[model samples]
Target: MSFETALKTAQDDIQATLTDLLVAFDGPVGDAMRYATGGGKRLRGFLVLETSALLDVPRERALRAAAAIEAVHAYSLIHDDLPCMDDDNLRRGQPTVHRKWNEATAVLAGDALQSAAFEWLAAPLTHPDASVRAELVLTLARDAGATGMVWGQALDMAAESAEDPLTLEQITELQRLKTGRLLEWPCRAGAILGQADPVHLLRYAADIGLAFQIADDLLDVEGEAATVGKAVGKDADAGKATFVSLMGADAARDRAHALVKSAQDVLLPFGTRAATLAAVARYVVTRDK
Candidate 1:
């Protein structure tokens, strides 16, 4: 199958599992959860499933992590669109959770989804070995908690009012935590499940994660709102520094290309089995959304 076909298949697979997780709960919170997760590229979840495939893990087991990561991703987007945060009214070309329901419902839905991610990770179905499940749980806490995504968000908020704009290194570090950490988890999670060394995937994740953000920054600068989803130029509107702002547009694009190369190179350990992942790394730099 082609890469696009494989990606679509993975997206469909994870969404079905995600729907099952949500439909069991009924209410506005459930509605909000479903709404928040309905669209987008399902890129994070795809990373999990594809990595698991390369590692020779069964899709049945990998599907659990893929669903869980997407739940966490949905929760993050809901919160990120909250009034106190980015205050976005639109997400994926539709009303954001807070706009569709209310702030309270959005908050509750995000909380529920975040909690559900851990619940999914802890489930025996994700892995028969208690130790592997525990590792996923522990690493997820570190990546999504105060030290990771939250840390990046906090830094971003702080920079808005600061006298000096963030330096390139600072912004990169912030994005690595805010965006890179979550990206890191799924790639590494596959190896953790396979009982194989996760070190190489970590390298791949690190490169692709940064490239992903840089590509996003490029989109913000060059993409139309209709195509990009959400509003374009949000970072620039907020007067926040970005890779494009710091490194210049041409240079930022170059950096993302370079990172894609690094990402593909790291997967050499997996040889031909990793071709799809290498394709994904390239797609990360090219996707308009």
Candidate 2:
């Protein structure tokens, strides 16, 4: 199948899995969880599924991992939109969880989603081997916790108040933790599922992750709020230094392109089997939203 088709398929499957998994919970939190996970490109989940496929892992097992990552991603978005955070009112062109319900409800919903992600990873359905499940759980926790995504978030919050704007290197480190780790987790999880070496996949994920962030920076500067489905220009308005702000739009775009090339080049060993994955690297930099 084509890469676009595969990506869309992955998105559909992951969304269904998330919906089914959360169907049993009946409450405001449950509804908010559903709402928060309702729409997105599902890029991280797609990475899990695609990388798993490259390793010949079982589809059911891969699907569980994909859903787990999506849950974690959705939880991050919900919390990131909180008033104490990015204070975003819109997400995916819809009211953010905190705005739709309330801050307390949004917090509870995000908390539940995060917990559910670990629960899914720990479940036998995710992998028959307990060791594999354990590794997935441990790595995900580390990557999503204070040492990873949270670290990035903390840095971001601090950056907002600092008298000086962050340097390019500092911002790169922050983005790697805040965004790259989650993106890397899916590829790493895919390798774990198939018991394959993850060196190349991990490397590919790192490049893709950075490129994704740079693309996001570009979008923030050039994309329409309606098309992007979120607030735009907020980064600049807030006096935040982004890839674009630090490197200029053309330089940032070129850097993203170079990262995409590096990402795709690393997949050469997989040959045609990795075409879709390679396509994703290019898509990250080229996508309008």
Candidate 3:
């Protein structure tokens, strides 16, 4: 199947589980959580399914992990859109959680979603092997906590208030932690479920993850808010440093292209089995949003 078609198919699978899981909860928090997680490209979750497919992982375990990732992603976005953070008013072409509901609702929903993610990961149904489930939980905790996504976010928030702008190297390190880590996890999920060596997919993930951030930086510079489905140009307005800011647009674009090329190269060992992932890497750099 074509990349877009395959991606959509994956989205359908992930979203159904995501919706079911959230709806099982009760109260306004559950309502808010469902709303917050309702829409997006589901790219991270898609990575899990695609990687699972490539590795021949069982569908049941893969789908659970995919849903788990989507929950975490939605929580991150809800928190990221808070007034104390990016203060985004829109997401996925709809009102951000904080704007649509309230800050308290958003915060509670995000917190609950995060808790649910761990619960899902810890569930025995995700994998028959207890060790595998434990590993997923432990690794996710590391990547999503102070050591990874949160670390990057703290750096970003600090940069906003600092007297001096962050250097290019600093920005790169920040993005790697904030965005790249979670993206990498979905790829690793494939190997985790299939019980295969993950070295190559991990490398492929690193390159594409960086490319993904670079592309986001580019979108901030070149895309329309309507098209991007969120407020665009905020980075520039806030005087934040990004790939485009550090390298110049031309250089940044070239860098993203080069990263995508290397990403494809890393998957050579998997050959055609890696085609979907390779397409995802290219799409990361090329997507308008």
Best by lDDT: 2
lDDT tens string, model 1, 202-227?
A: 99999999999999999999998998
Which parts of model 1 are misplaced by more than 4 Å? Answer: none
Per-candidate local distance difference test:
0.91, 0.93, 0.90
lDDT of 3 at 52: 91
For each of the candidates, give the backbone clash count. 0, 0, 0
lDDT of 2 by residue, 116-174 (tens): 99999998988889999999999999999999999999999999899999999999999
Ranking the candidates on TM-score from highest down gives 2, 1, 3
TM-score (all chains, Cα) for each model: 0.98, 0.99, 0.98
**Superior candidate under lDDT, 1 versus 3:** 1
lDDT of 3 by residue, 1-289 (tens): 9999999988888878888777778887888898887778888998999899988988778989888888888899999999988888999899998888899999999999999999998998999899999988888888889999999999988998999999989998999999998999998888888898889889988999999999999999999999999989889998888899889999999999999999999988888988989999999999988
Which parts of model 3 are misplaced by more than 4 Å? Answer: none
Give candidate 2's whole-model lDDT. 0.93
What ranking of all candidate models by lDDT puts the best one first? Answer: 2, 1, 3
